[model samples]
Target: MEIRLAGIKEFSVADGPGIRTVIFTQGCKNRCKGCHNISTWDLNGGYIQEINSLISYIDSICPNKKVTISGGEPLIQYNELKYLLKVLYKKNIIYAYIQATI
Candidate 1:
């Protein structure tokens, strides 16, 4: 499975309750006025990445093995995100958050 991403933060404390690996998923419907990730608004703008690759990287370097599926809006790519979560769950990785609006 593949996902479009704005960026990935391998180690981030601010995104979740603990040190987490944040997946900045691309595409958002709501153009919130205060959105920090202006670049992520475009659904086609970010790079395409294999979900396996992201999981593998997180497994290797993220000490907590925790992931935060953040976004422009995560639900924009629901199928890919779902697969990513399934893979992460199989690995016993602790996924801290999955943000979506509607």
Candidate 2:
């Protein structure tokens, strides 16, 4: 299965520990008062991203770094996040963080 994504940010230090890969999944139920990416709330707002391709992209990045799943609410697409975490866990990268609003 695939998830809709607003965008992906690579090598971000603010996301978590060390340089990180940040995946911004699309769609959100919460309309925050001061959301940075306020444009992403629409349920059908972003492009569909293949899970395999995203994993491959993450694989291509330097390991031993952090990975973050931010939103537009990552829990909105829990399956993909769960699957991605499984892959990251197997690779011994335990620093995957999630930034979402409920």
Candidate 3:
């Protein structure tokens, strides 16, 4: 599955406990006034990444670091996100957190 990604930010402190890889997904309808990621609001914007590639990138970065998923809204890609979470859950190498705007 191809997912719309705003960007990948590595080694963030405020996102979660310890160093984390943050996946900022694209497409958010919420349009909150105080949204930090206002640039990712457009669903048409951002790179389209395949599920496998995303997994590989996350795996490669799983060097004792957690994986935090944030975005315009990850639940917009619910099915794909679910799959990715499942895989991450199985690895047990990276902790995962999904920050929902809702």
Candidate whose lDDT is highest = 3
* Residue-level lDDT tens digits of model 2 in 1-102: 788999999888888778888888899989889889887898899899888788778878855557888889889888887887888788776677989777
The parts of candidate 2 lying over 4 Å away from their true place are: none
After superposition, which runs of candidate 1 have C-alpha atoms over 4 Å from their true positions? none
- Please give each candidate's TM-score: 0.92, 0.89, 0.93
Scored by Cα lDDT, where does model 2 land?
0.83
Report the Cα lDDT for residue 86, model 1: 85
Count of clashes in candidate 2: 0
TM-score quality measure for candidate 3: 0.93
Q: Which ten residues in a row have the lowest lDDT in candidate 2?
A: 57-66
Q: After superposition, how far is residue 86 of candidate 1 from its true place, in Å?
A: 0.7
Number of backbone-clashing residue pairs for each candidate, in the order shown:
0, 0, 0
- The lDDT for every candidate, in the order shown, is 0.85, 0.83, 0.87
Q: Model 3 over residues 14-51: C-alpha lDDT tens digits? A: 89898888999998999898888899899999989998
Specify the poorest-scoring 10-residue window by lDDT in model 1. 93-102
The order of the candidates by TM-score, greatest first, is 3, 1, 2
